[model samples]
Target chain A: MQITVLAGGVGGARFVRGLLSHLRTRDDAEQTSVTVVGNTGDDITLVGLRVCPDLDTLLYTLGDGVDEGQGWGRAQESTRVAGELATLGVGPDWFTLGDLDLATHLARSRWLAQGLTLSEVTARLAQRWGLPDRGVRLLPATDTPIETHVVVDDGEGGERAIHFQEWWVRHGASLPARRFTVAGLGEAKAAPHVLDALRTADVVLFPPSNPVVSIGIILGVPGVREALRGTRAPVVGVSPLLGGRPVRGHADACLAPLGVEVSAAGVAGLYADFLDGWLVDDADAGLRYPAGAQVRSMDLLMRDTEGAARLAGAALDLGRELSPVGAGTRGPR
Target chain B: MQITVLAGGVGGARFVRGLLSHLRTRDDAEQTSVTVVGNTGDDITLVGLRVCPDLDTLLYTLGDGVDEGQGWGRAQESTRVAGELATLGVGPDWFTLGDLDLATHLARSRWLAQGLTLSEVTARLAQRWGLPDRGVRLLPATDTPIETHVVVDDGEGGERAIHFQEWWVRHGASLPARRFTVAGLGEAKAAPHVLDALRTADVVLFPPSNPVVSIGIILGVPGVREALRGTRAPVVGVSPLLGGRPVRGHADACLAPLGVEVSAAGVAGLYADFLDGWLVDDADAGLRYPAGAQVRSMDLLMRDTEGAARLAGAALDLGRELSPVGAGTRGPR
Candidate 1:
């Protein structure tokens, strides 16, 4: 079976890590291949180095090099480069690049500057992390340079736009953004193999990524939404929200501008056109979901790897139930 | 009085630091300002970041942030970024960038990409190092991108060119070179203020930097050599060679391709067209020098800051003695 996952940074990385862990215990582990399409909307050029927050988190988390406490970045990371940059006043003080983490940006930036596509750079980075050996392929949603910007009041009754990172990382998403704008989303084609991964997958998973910026940004890529809606795969997603609140990050703040309710059902509504199975926290089990979507409720708090694996197992079970009659048992389709 | 110095990396930086030390003990210290024109031939883009080895050495050494033992890079540096790059197979393993040192390149590369000239970027970097406060200004020889390429036998009866850094750092200059070709040198104009610094200075000094690749490359810039020849200031130089041997670096190897003798007199001859005074080690005190150039002998081994200061003092004294009667005491020429 080929599983395609759309993911963001921390929460999404953790969910996919759990899914991989869950798959490891299955009889068909060797037969299962996973393709992850990572969101690149959070990408920013910091100090002339390209930094893909979501892709790096996925690489670190799955490679077993992630900081368990922070759920992102490298384990045993040091901030020597960041400290030096601060002393030189080169980059923003709030967004620190760890010494170990900087190597990723440096490699990515170097490769990109050499004219290699982002997908090519990601593949090279993935090799170092042994992703291929684990039957995992990570790719950016789009190769085109795109960045999410947040429009906010400039304190003069006018609006101004700041890179999403400043809004998210620096301001903690508390800057009351009027709206989110992706610079190149409309023109960006899905990266190589991205549409194919979605179109040909047996199961398509949305791993609790931010609906407004993460998965939404991926869907904004040309042909991506159509691929998801047209794929023969059973599309299952875990809700990022529970009891009108997100487990982490400022999901509510992101949804507020769109006037979407900050609830599991509201998030499910965002994917109503293509979603097959929807898993929500037990606290929101009574909420009504979109028609044609199979709603399931569970204890969604991923407190540890084991808890994450359990949640992933439930999502896979839901995907199996939603799969068409002969599709669930069929070989690579 | 204005003093202009033509310099390279380690040796030049140490000499200038020593010169600053020597001047501090003089009553006219507050009245003297130094302008250092650093070689850009050693500059290379590594891992997509511009690395100005010579200029960085000057900054770190003069800023009191240099690794004293290595004579370059930052103090208390860590190679976490380099180590990570190695793990990712990002750059040449032969060259390593310390975490603290990488920050300087990042800032420089960033500023350059943002449309700032190398000289403008250097000024910002100098501000951080408190260069202005010390009445010191460091400028690249030319703002136009130029790199020294070493032509060497390809071990196949053919000749190929490699970056000067690869020759100097990677191969340790062990490879026999046919010649040195500086890309962009012919078409490059001297950096803003560089020609003016030389033309209007009261005195000029050459530190014991490599004659072939350092001061030689700077002189190769258009108008620079002419500026030196026409300048009213007395030009004095410290020989890079003593007893037919360089104190550091592969100066002999660099001079071999040009068919020049690797001796104090030979190095003095390279600057004979404008050189008014020449200082050599006590061992080369008896060597024959070019006509019209004043010769002085000194214990020129700069084993420490004090030793460097003593040697700098000797060079300064030679410049004073050789200066035109009215020129030596003039203010800023």
Candidate 2:
């Protein structure tokens, strides 16, 4: 089966890992292939190095190099570089980057400076982590910069714009965001294989990533939403919330800016136009979804890999049930 | 006294530290100022960050951040970034860069990318390290890259050119170099304040650094030689060799390729045209210097900071003797 997943940072990585784990146990597991469309809205250049937080999170987590405790960054990473940078006063003191993590940024920045596109650089980086051997392919949502910026109160008089990272990481997303705007969205076209992935996949999944910044940003790309609506494959989404609160991260803070209620029903409403199946946590079973979508409530607490796999398995089964009988499965590996 | 030292890497750093220490105890020390013209030929860009071995050697050694036992690099440094880079197969495995050291390079590279000259970048880096507060000013010989390349036997009966680091650090300079050439030397002009320091200095001393690569490369810069010869200040040089062998490093290997004999007298010959006084170890007291240069013998082993200070003091006294009466020492602070 060819499974295409739209993902964000830590949460997305966890879901993808669980999906891969779930596929491994299937009778036809050897024939299964996964392609992940990673959000690039959180990307930024820090200290002259291009850093794609979401893509790196997925790559490190899936490649078995992630700091398990933090669910992001490299295992056993040191902040010596950050400390030294602080001494030099070269970069912002807010964002803390680890020494081992810097190697990836350095490599990516060099390759990008040599004129490689984001998609090409992502492939090169993934190749080093042996993502291909694991039957997983990761690509950015768009090749061009499509950085998300939040409009927030400047604490003086007028409102000002700040990069998503500063808004989320530095401020802890505490300040009320007036709205979110993607700087390069109007000019950004989907990466080469993105539309094709939707067109050819047996099923497409939206992991429990932040709706506004993650899946929302990916869908904002020009032809991406149209492609999803036009594809014959069933589209499914899993709620990032459990009992009206995000299972991980501050999705409610993101949702507030869009005036969307911080509930499973509110998240489902954002994807209702094309979503064929929607899965909410059992805690949110009382909530209502749109008419055309088939809603199912399951235990969505991804407390461990096993729990994550079970949730992923539930989403896949829902997708299979919604798709046309023979079209539910992919032909071969 | 205003002192200008032509220096490179470890030896130069040691001499400067000692010189600083010696000045601290002098009655006129408060008036004393020192400028170190560091060799840039040994510099290399590894993994996109500029690595100035000579200037960094002086800065770290003087600023109390150098690995004392090694005479170079950061004290208490970690190689986490290098290890990660190895895993990614990004840069050559031969040149090991520590995490703390990489911060300096990254800062420099970022500044250089912003169109800051190496001299400006060096000053900024030095400021952070508090080199200025230590009464030391470090400047590159030239702003343009003057990397030393070695032509060596490629082990297949044909000659190949490799960077000096690869020749020295990787191969341990085991292969006999056919010749040494400085890339961009013809185009490289003296960095800002280089000629000015030489022009207005009370005395100029050549530290016991590699004569062929360190002090030699500095003199190769177009106007530097002219400034040294034309300056009214007395020029003094200390032999890197002691008892017919280099005190440290492979100065002999480099000198042999240029047909310069690996001895104290031979080293003094290279500087005789500009040098007024020369210092050598007591072991080489019998060796005669060229006609115009006065010679002195001393115990030149810088076994510790105290020994280095004493040697520096002896060089200053010798320079004072060579200068026309009342022309050597600077006015009071």
Candidate 3:
């Protein structure tokens, strides 16, 4: 299967890992190529070093470098830099940089300074650790930098913007944002491989990543949404929301700002144009989509890599079934 | 009393800490300025962040922010960055950065990007923590970004050039460097206040830092040695070496490259012409100096702030005792 996975942070990374494990077990790994388009909306430049929190999270997690404790940064990390920054009175104190994780950011920043695009940098870094090549590839959504900023009332009546990382990682979505903007999206172009990956895909899988911000932001990139719409392949999306709320993250708060209900149906509507199939949890099987996008419910929690691959396999099967070659297609063929 | 101390690394920083402590205990709350001209030989841009090890040592030691474990960098530091860098296979692993220490470099890098000089950046950072105003100043000896490179035999009888930080920190001075070059020293000028500070000095104290590479390199700066020679103030130097070896650092090896002995007498001879008094350890009291210089012996081991102050006070006292005024001469009469 030629699969393209639209991803966000921890959840996306976890699902990718699961998909890798399953592909390896299936013995058809050589045939399946997984292209992950990562979210860069949470990127920030702190003290002059550019930090891509979500991208790093995905890379570290999938590369088996993630700290087991946090499941975000690398394992065996230390917070020496954070402590020093604190002493210097700089904060979003809640987020800590593990020692092992800093290396990725440093290398990324160094490479970026040397004139490499984010896509090129991502490819080089992934090749360094040899991410599962049997069916796996990681790509950034755009060449131009895009920052997701949330506008919140700055303790008074007036509203100001805070970087997405600060709002998500630091505030933990405790404060509500009046609105959100994907800054620089006007100038952003989809990564070189994104359109090609989407067009040639047998299945386009939207992993259970942040909908309003992460995967949504990737789909918003120029040419990506259009590519998916024109794809001859089936498109399936796994819902990040389950039972009308997020298992993690403030997706509900985020959804409220966009007027999207906190349910699989609500999220499915956002990707409704090209989504041929929607995967929700068994708990939300009772839910209905008015436009009647082919829907199924499964055990969607990716508790382990095996579970992630299981969910991936099921989604792929559903997408295949929904396509012209699938069981649900008309008998004309 | 305005006091200027020429410093290198650990020993120099400790001595200045003592000086800062002594200044605090004075009967009068009047200004007791301390101008520290820190050695820049060890400076190198690793992954492009300028790190000043010795200067930061002095800053952290005096302000109670130093890591007591290593007596350098900040306290409660983490190593997430170091671990990550190691994983990424960056060089000079021996000169590792605590995560907290990286914040200083990152902040300094950021400030430098905004057109701030190292001196201005250092002052701004010092102000954040409220450093003692006895005119506390940390200067980089010169404004130019001159790097020190070491040439070592390449095992095939040819010499290979490596940065000073790599040679010293990584190799642990195990390999011999045929030469140490402070590239661009001939054209370098003492950063604005250096000459003015030295010329107006009531006393000049050379802390027990690596004299050959530290103080020697500073003296190599154009118009700097001249400033010291032309000053009416007495310059007193404390020996980094006691009997024949340095208590810390590979001063012995550094001196060998310069054909100077690793002894109190050797250092005294180097500074003799412009020196007023040379302080050696009591064990090295019999050490001799060149013509026209007085010699004194004291406990120069600055184990803590009290020890630092005592040594600093001793240097100050030696300065007054050797000067024309204290000697009851009419302005060198």
Candidate 4:
């Protein structure tokens, strides 16, 4: 089976880990392949280094080098560089980057400065983590620069837009966001192999990640949504919300700014144009989704790797059941 | 009094610290201003950051942040970033850059990228360390790229040139250097204020630094040597050698490649055309020097900051004695 996932940072990383674990247990695991199209809206330049938080999170988590406690950044990381940078009065003091993580940014930024695409740089980093050895491939959603910015009240009569990281990390998303703007979205095309991954995949899964910025940013790319709508694969999505609150992060805050109800059905409706199957928490089982999509309820909270694997298994089952050709089509793409 | 000193790394840093201490004890201490022309020949781009080892040493040593025990680098420094970079296979594994030091480089590189000259960057860094408040100014010998490379046997049959840092730090200068070449020397002009500092000085001193690479490279810059020769201020130098061996670093090895005897007289002879006075260790007191230059023997070893100050006081007294118009000829230029 060829499974492709649209992922964000922490939540998507956990889901991808679970999905990889689920595939590992199958007898024909060698025949299974996974491709992850990671969100690039969260990328930022810190101290002249290009930092892709979501991509680094995925690599560190899957490579077993992530700090499990924080659910992001490298294990055994030190903030000496960041502390010194603060002492030097350079960069944003609020965004604390670890020394080991800064090395990744340095390497990636150097390569990018040498004219490599984001997809190429991501592949180089993933290879260092041996992602390919585990039958997994990670690519950015778009190679073009596409940053997510939040328009928030500047605390006076007017409003100003700030980088998504400033809103999420610095402000804790406390300030009311007037709207979210995807900068460069109109010019961004899917990264190399992204369209192909969607078009040729047996199944596509959206993990319990923020619908607006994570998968939504990926869908915002010029050709991504068209690829999903035209692909023969069944697209399945898991709810990022439970009991009208996010399982992790401030997905509710993100949805509220868009005037969308903070519920499973609301998240599902955002993807109703292409979503064939939707998975919500048991608490939200009775919530009505769009007409054509098959709805199911299961344990969606990924508390641990084992829980993630179980959740991933549930999503896979739903995607397989929704496929017109069923489990093993044996068709060569 | 306006004093200008030519400096290198560790030894020069120790000498400058002593000079500052000597000036501090004077009644007109606040009136004494010192300008140091730092060697940039040892600089290398490690991991894309322009690292000036000598300049950093001068800043850290005077700023009380240097590792006193090691005589270079920051105190209580961590190499977490260097370790991570090695793991990523990004930079030279043998050259370990501490996390705190890397911050300086990153800030400098970022500023340089933003179009700041190396001299401007050095001043910015010095101000951060409060050097300006202490009446000390540090400037690079030249703003142009003038790296020293040593031609050595490739260990096969032919010879190849390698960066001075690689030759010094990695090989420990074990390979016999056929000759030393200062790359970009022809194009390197004295950095801003170098000539002004030299020409308008009450006295000029050459601290016991490596003659071949450090002070030699500085003199090689167009107009620097001419300024020293034309300046009315008495030029005095402290020997970096004591019994035919340098107080610190591989000065002897550097001298050997050029057939210059690693002795006090040999070093003083190189500057005979411009030097008005030379200070050698008591052990080499009987040694003969070139004509027209007064020679004195003193305790040149800077065992501590106090010892360094005493030595610096001796150099100042010798410079005053050599001046045609004695000590208090405070004539307006």
In the range B137-229, model 4's lDDT, one tens digit per residue, is 999999997899999998789999999999999999888999999899989989989999999898999999999889999999999999999
> What's the candidate order when arranged by decreasing TM-score?
1, 2, 4, 3
DockQ of structure 2: 0.77
Residue A256 CA error for candidate 1 (Å)?
1.6
The candidate that achieves the highest DockQ relative to the unseen native structure? 1
**Cα lDDT of model 2 by residue, B1-333, tens digit:** 679999999999999999999999988877788999999998998877889988888888988999998899999988988988887777888898999989999999999999999999999988987888988889999999889999998889999999999999998888899999899999999999999999888989899999988999999999999998888788988889999898789999989998987888999988877888899999999987778888899898989999999989988998887777544454321
What's the lDDT for residue A93 in model 1? Answer: 86
TM-score of candidate 1 relative to the true fold: 0.97
Error of 2 at A235 (Å): 0.7
Q: Model 4 chain A, poorest ten-residue lDDT window?
A: A324-333
What's the lDDT of the predicted structure labeled candidate 2?
Answer: 0.90
Classify candidate 1 by CAPRI docking class. high
lDDT, candidate 2, A212-295, per-residue tens = 999999999989999888777889999999999997788999999788989999999999889999999888989877778899
| Residue A56 error, candidate 4, Å | 0.8
Identify the runs in model 4 with alpha carbons over 4 angstroms from their true place.
A155-158, A330-333, B154-158, B328-333
**Clashes by residue pair, model 1:** none
Better of 1 and 2 by lDDT: 1
- Which regions of candidate 1 fall more than 4 Å away from where they truly are? A326-333, B326-333
Q: In model 1 chain A, where is the ten-residue run with the lowest total lDDT?
A: A324-333
